[model samples]
Target: MRKLALNDEILLKIEKPARYIGNEVNSVMKDKNEVDIRFAMCFPDVYEIGMSNLGMAILYDMFNKREDVWCERLFSPWTDLDKIMREKKIPLFALESQEPVRDFDFLGITLGYEMCYTNVLQLLDLSQIPFLAKERGEEFPLVIGGGACAYNPEPLAEFFDLFYIGEGETAYDALFDAYIANKKAGGTKKDFLLKAAQIPGIYVPAFYDVTYQEDGTIASFTPNQPEAPSKVEKQLVMDMDRDYNFLEAPVVPFIKATQDRVTLEIQRGCIRGCRFCQAGMIYRPTRERDIEDLKEAARIMLKNTGHEEISLSSLSSSDYSELKELVNFLIDEFRDKAVNISLPSLRIDAFALDVMSKVQDVKKSSLTFAPEAGSQRLRNVINKGLTEEDILHGAGQAFEGGWNRVKLYFMLGLPTETEEDMKGIAHLAEKIAERYYEIPKDKRNGKVQINVSTSFFVPKPFTPFQWAPMFREEEFIEKAKIVKNEIRSQLNQRSIRYSWHEPDVTVLEGFLARGDRRSSKVILKAYEKGALYDAWSESFRYDIWKEAFAETGVDMEFYTLRERDTDEILPWDFIDAGVSKEFLIREWKQAKAETVTPNCRQRCSGCGAKRYGGGVCHEGQN
Candidate 1:
């Protein structure tokens, strides 16, 4: 019998014992004694939240497919179980094997967002692992970070031994083989790290030394070790249909998960180059999975998991050339089985409205639109490529389709945003409400509920807006008030609801998103001062972060408030994200000129993903 860290008594006391239990339907079970590498894949969030992550699921399934690797799932315990485990001195364990994560050969934590820095620390502390990467020895698990946040890994460099930049599918096979060979040769941890740094996508922060100018800007960042490359190019899996594993039998959770359904990734990357979107820029040159493959994956996953619904996952679902075909196929195939198809990240076009009408309940469901900016001019500035006319037309179509509720997403504190632009958000919402009223009273399904939400935009690395300056908390709030006041003054006040994200969290995210190696001290200090689950508004302590910044002598304003010159070197400059800096700089200039550039599909802007000779560029040549 495998030894469980949590006993029966402890498990019984926790709210969801299923979260800690090892066995779940379709969860990979391997003989630890047989495998050479024990990989514990973790998402530094609650079980429900982590289980919903498709990337984690794909990686877990991929790793387990290797004969010599025993890969198991791990997630940060909820407060209830967390308290009991810490008090009882029970080390954190993987869900499949119920073995302590400390004993695992590799601990891969996916850093999808900046807010999870504290939770990463909590995971380490609970696992009885050293908080800092430097403090651990050969006996300790090699901590690796990946995902979107790993693109800008400076704020987290001190904690993770190495960061795997870019797509997970491209580099892991080489990584595992190297690890197994090193283990056989009885290599030291330093030796393994040096070898790991030799891999194309692997970035070992300790091998790089960063010097700062008197003004706290990065003066120079040079590689110390000969093995470590000066520039770590992000790995891109070009052939999605061939290389990508559409996870066939994802582990079915016994309890409810955030996304309690089979998720089929229809595509990777986005064609629309929204300037503020980090995902769009980082995941360059759009690639769509074959429709036949998607159908098979969807069928197998749903059948294995016995899920009631299946979601088509992608950055932009509507942009997928075969979206209609895929969605229709899913509906036709799963209709008899009573499996609903969830199509998110869609443009509110006529086709989308028609498809949505079939799958969703018109009364209960709310149609979501990410206008990104409130005004057309501002939309052009951000390269959103969405017009005000598109919003009204889409809303009208939805109203006609018997959808009453509409959720509109916008970003506050965008570069060069005016008070008029803020009011435009309300104007757009009000127009949507009016469109609802335009429908004949007898023809209408229900009352209109337009929810307008704004989040403060934090400039991210590898984006045209990377040099954009973030507003102070007060400025963000004041701008939000401009929209709120305009909404309240509208005739559709009752139908429209206005809400904005917490400015404090936005400020913190801005700091972390663009911070350098020096900013890692602030994160460490904040975690030491009891910062966990900073993503949750209720759990965030701004004062603690403030104190950490002060103590570390790191100014948050230096990261958030200052706009960089076009020629200045950024913290993430070394990581070649495939999207050229020259292209981004050009786009930035276009934004300033209020000139809209067409997407990759329309015309090649020469973003340098073409150099990879894949995705849209390859197809364009054909």
Candidate 2:
């Protein structure tokens, strides 16, 4: 490990110096002579935010459980600290020992989202490692990636040596044990990677060769090495509760984080089966932790952190079968402690509303609903399964229950969307506003505030709409304009506020989400042109991305705005996510025909979960 001369003056000059400092409680430290394998668990973001993530904490705890293995945390420094490090010539260091990241045997980065692509390259360069995998030789640490983004890692494949798809609880340990055995035999990095590639769920990009046809579609992806598997199967833990819960005692940050309170996951997947939702598909076979387990985790977390609020996190909290009982338990447990319990993803239903009323005082709380589409027909096409009456009835209940402010979430550019469907958004908002006025003037609050936030729909892998074309930026903006104008002209009231996400940004995201290995060049080039934090609206640069696409001779529109054939080979075809391609095709056909698939918990649609030998997931079972 290269050590830089410590300059106290410069350290004091940067913001959040604690981020650069390497000492924290509960951090692992093992002697170089004692440990056989050194792993750096990296989150491609800053310290305060990364430390709070449950995935990082779980892997950190799991890897450290092995006496022969030592794992440390690494995160991308903020722009202010990055400036200082560049000026001071300091390499990226681990948060535990202050050692450079290059010294570790494996640099395991968790890819949480597409926006963090540029940050990965920034961290690699800051660590003094070659940004591209091909440029790095035997001396470099093996680079691996995991997390939700690993499901579709084609766009960033060139940077990572391998990708651990799906759940990492079991696969990570299996790979580490293999690495430890290989390293003890004095094996080379390539030799160990070859051996690791043989393990299920580990995808080694170097062993695979990608060829594109004249039309820019993938022609073939062949494995050059015999040890590599022809196809990689994603890893899934059979039991989540028996696994690790590392969020019980989170690392308190010196500065405020994006979400400062404790978060307890009530469930793992969604049962609604929204076609446009990547999370819904990626996290299949909706699994809910036991209510008793959740309550205990919350109690322990609150006792340890003294946090004033707790967020019940999941793809959809309302779908949890025991949601009412869980919320009641939490409210009773924390009511005297003055800790407010928050449920973020609530559906528009009476049962969900009843649960909310039990935990929160309606007068003091704000409600949020994600109808997703404006009209019933559009909702059916997306498999949202939400009726127009559900929205109106839910809004009326909110107004009658004394909640004055409600936030509604919708999407603009869905597959097979029409102008009439876009106008229905305004109609829904106006109906909600009228519902608010129907309440007695004395019972009504000062004013009812309706906030409608719309975002462009982006096609994602492993979904029914994977072959669908995203609406062009101009088309999406025109639709947004229609929705905006209709809302303003109909409501004529400042109480209703309408906002839409930028369409160009969504187009770029679509390009990255479904891109192949060749797209890494565009990402690195864009990063070189100063594109970091594309997820944040303030830091997004459309021009830089366009320039990068142009220099690489890559047509962004071809990837984002072109409809694909059902028989076309997808970049993620080699990855088996437990859901069959036939099922996805069936769902796509059902979506186009406006047929709603029943929730799996209610009835099995033969989606292949039973093949794993587990019946439909329920409350008590793992």
Candidate 3:
């Protein structure tokens, strides 16, 4: 529990020294004796990246608001620091108090994605705590995980003692209260975890016995106690407006983070229910806060952080009901001081462009649009409602306006995609270039630049494409090469640039995304083989993943390239995500027929979310 003195010479040798020093504006500090439950909110990455996460800020603020609880931040040290820590035997410590993470009563890790699994183990090991739940005694810190990855916690079930399945707003409060009562009774960690498992959204891994068949499928999962629910329902915050108040002022990092400026979330969830998008399915029923509240938050954030740029972020910023008014208000408020307003998720529409032109002061800022697919038929198959005309019109508007650089995002191997459909990607880019040329020279502000980025499609769970087969690495690479060759041969435009994600990396992601408990062994093995950040292409080692899969006797292709039957139970079935299986199956059928389902906000396709509703539709709300 001793505070480690800063070695200035070693700090200078490492990258981003400011990341290690965690003191910042709006950070919470409290006396350990004053709190009943001491919680360490851990993010499995460096401090700069972890501090930037809005969820961490919200939870930190909420827990500290409680007079009886104190929560602090914990992050994995960088590689150089990790080595130094091992040599010096420095235990992982919290930022606010500089106390060892092992000293906390509860260690709560917020898992955002699959890539951070290794860092979780590393963090635990560095803290001198047992990595596995069974290995750790009752005296050890209670290890719990939450966030998006917790929705499918089967893979990491062996490591975590419990999981908070959904939103933490209400569940977190319930958990801490239960812990306090258990502590008053002088209960053990096991006793407390057993009681905590009875909570609505909590899942205790120790109480469940997972049996696997010879084919590596889950045979059964039996609970040891009657207190556990048969299926844990994901917790959802009914009111987003009330929740936004919990995040009044986020901590500004000392160093430049990935998102270096103030980010105000304009809305939650997406109404355009694209079949391939996991985020849309996971965050169902789009909800927006009041525009006045958003403007006020932005103004406060700008004044506190002195951030030159403010990004209005959401799944789709253009879909916000009062986007024009929000933009105008921000522009009018910040124009005199030269603050930049950025709409991060603008849809491909004329009105969105018009709003952007009015709000964005910099004419040189690049515009980005995601058509998702090349052709209209392919787009329909993925439930991407954007038509070819929408892209053309949107690009035309950008060209007609002062903006010259346009970036378009697309996917390579979608379900039911063909070579002709792949070729259509190049054809569409050439057409956009042609449209740029058609614009008058005076209107065309500068040389036109068309940047196309293609990424391999990885089938995710809880989506319409969950049962679809992903293309093999070889096939994906071939298709990408074909698209690149076709574009160069046909259009031969110098201003147009094409880049693609590595297919091998996508194959690894595919294996992890839809994998079962058995995949955990593969992940652990790969991590031991130095797979720190597999998501980054430069750091990804395909051989390590391949070797891990081979050693574990788990077939990567069987999980990635094989389609599952509709009646089959998935690994994530035990966790209820609010969406019905019947609705997903129907959407899958529609996708196969190349039929598009309209956004639920516009029309009710009976997706079953109305069962838990504030207002079923926009008209219903009206």
Model 3: per-residue lDDT, tens digit, 1-622? 4353346876887777676666778777777998898999999987877877877777887888899999888787888888888888988888778778888888999998777788888888888898788899867788999988787788888888899987778688889999999999999888898889889899998787778777666788778877777798877765777754446667777778777778887777778889998788777767788787888888888888878888888888878889888888888888888888777888857777777787766655788879878889999999888888888888888888777888989999999999989988888888888888898777777778889899999888889899999888899999999889878975536877999999888887787788777778887887778777665556667898888888878788988888888877687888878777888999999999999898876688776666656533444741
TM-scores of the models, in the given order? 0.98, 0.95, 0.96
From the highest TM-score down, the ranking of the candidates is 1, 3, 2
Residue-pair clashes per prediction, in order, are 0, 0, 0
Error of 2 at 283 (Å): 1.2
Compare the candidates by lDDT and give the number of the best one.
1
Q: What is the lDDT of residue 218 in candidate 1?
A: 84
lDDT of 2 by residue, 1-622 (tens): 5243345786677777767665554466677678887888899887777866877777887788788888888888888878877877888878776788898888989888888899999889889999888889878889999998898888988898899987777677778888888877988888888998988899998998888898888899889999988889887765767763445666556556677788887777677788998888777777678788888889888887667889988888887879888888888887888888778888867776777777786466778878888899999999887888888899898788778898989998898889999998988888888899988899898798989999999888999999999878999889999998889877535777999999888998899889998788899999999988787788788999989999988888888889988888789998988778898899999988988888776666766655554325533233
Candidate 2 Cα misplacement greater than 4 A, ranges? 1-7, 22-25, 29-33, 244-247, 361-363, 615-622
Clashing residue pairs in candidate 1 are none
Model 1 steric clash total: 0
Query: Model 1 reaches what TM-score against the true structure?
Result: 0.98
